[model samples]
Target: MRNVRPWRLVAAWVIVILMATTVPFPSGLIETGPFPFDKVVHFGLYAVLGWTVHRAVRAGGGRRPLSILAAWAVGIAFGALDELHQHLVPGRDPSVADWAADAAGYTAAFLASSVLARKSSRKEQR
Candidate 1:
């Protein structure tokens, strides 16, 4: 059996994020108090995006350094585009804070992925 293409997985996840952003939410649905839960959701969503992008890059035969850089670029670029796309959605105004959260989430995921990959590679070498 052939392995599923990693880039296809990335595209599917991207579509999911886009579809989710296209929906209009009820008033106060996204924000739930002094601490906006919306940012958490954004962070979590983009975290997965980051992980997928990283895996896709590595699967595509990119070197470790290149995959890390590419994943960060793709994750941040998509986050920015998604923020702009929010302009068309009702009840959603794009905020820089959200983008920052997106970046932070992806950065965290990338670092974690790199560490895990290193460990796995070491195990394989043993």
Candidate 2:
């Protein structure tokens, strides 16, 4: 893997957070019935956030476990804050299910990254 600047990762994360908080959902866009598409959006957005956090941590010299923990923590906390912010929006309200989806996404991304890292390390060893 090429060397990645930690600050770049941080900047990306900040941009993602800003976008997530500032954007208002269009009416009927997230209201797909029978399948909870909002949850999927929450999951995808926070998964990217978690991946960026993990990359930033790793680039800054954090160990794998620490990076995973930090990614999950930051992702979930940010999700909670996003939900709270949504409550203030005219057409939006806070939902616990969204937060759960965010956490699940973060966990999935973190584990996937961990597995990939382990594989890479093993390949380097061999």
Candidate 3:
């Protein structure tokens, strides 16, 4: 509430992107799981993006909800764009459904963070 540390926020942003882009599953780590971790990849990425936005807003000494929400929306857009970018790669092709999943994850992350922030605010007021 008092200080907005720029370095810390940017560091978080980098870490989020790095973790999201790196697939540790070796392309065949799971053979027979009912639910593939591929979907989880989308969820975790967007959630981190949402959390990054929230953190950046807090870091910049901004308190308005819209700022964070805007950041989250941008994050979702970036996720979609990134997928499209992947299509240009030799081995990657974009999937609309995956983008939808990314959007869902982004929204879910934003909603969860907003609720948690609101709850924390209430607690601080008490």
Candidate 4:
């Protein structure tokens, strides 16, 4: 994949930047009081983005399924690390609930990728 397609990199970075801006970063402003949906947001956005980058990098390798799983796993670890970082942030206190939400997001992404791969594989046979 040319070590990294410039456009895909830009896309990924743009996604990351967009997500970073949108997600709550904890300004300690009024304490939204434990967002239940944050974890899902973490997983849903990151997993797809990570999988997209992985697929882009390995497009012709015929190894997308495994790569997608790895992307989700990496995202899980990242979510954990992210939560930890939040703990260190001045306005944010880390919560395991957030991490659980993250996992749920990853699972959702994984299922979505699997479905896509399955349909594509079937198309290839037809």
The C-alpha TM-scores of every prediction are 0.88, 0.80, 0.70, 0.63
Q: What is the lDDT of every predicted structure here?
A: 0.81, 0.73, 0.66, 0.60
Higher-ranked by TM-score: 1 or 3 = 1
User: How would you encode candidate 2's per-residue C-alpha lDDT over 24-124 as one tens digit per residue?
Assistant: 66655676788788788778877776676666666666775765676668667877887888877766777788788888887788667766767887999
Q: Identify the superior model by lDDT, candidate 1 or candidate 4.
A: 1
lDDT of 4: 0.60
3 or 4, greater by lDDT: 3
Best by TM-score: 1
Candidate with top lDDT is 1
* Candidate number with the higher lDDT (2 or 4): 2
Alpha-carbon lDDT of model 2: 0.73
Candidates arranged by lDDT, highest first: 1, 2, 3, 4
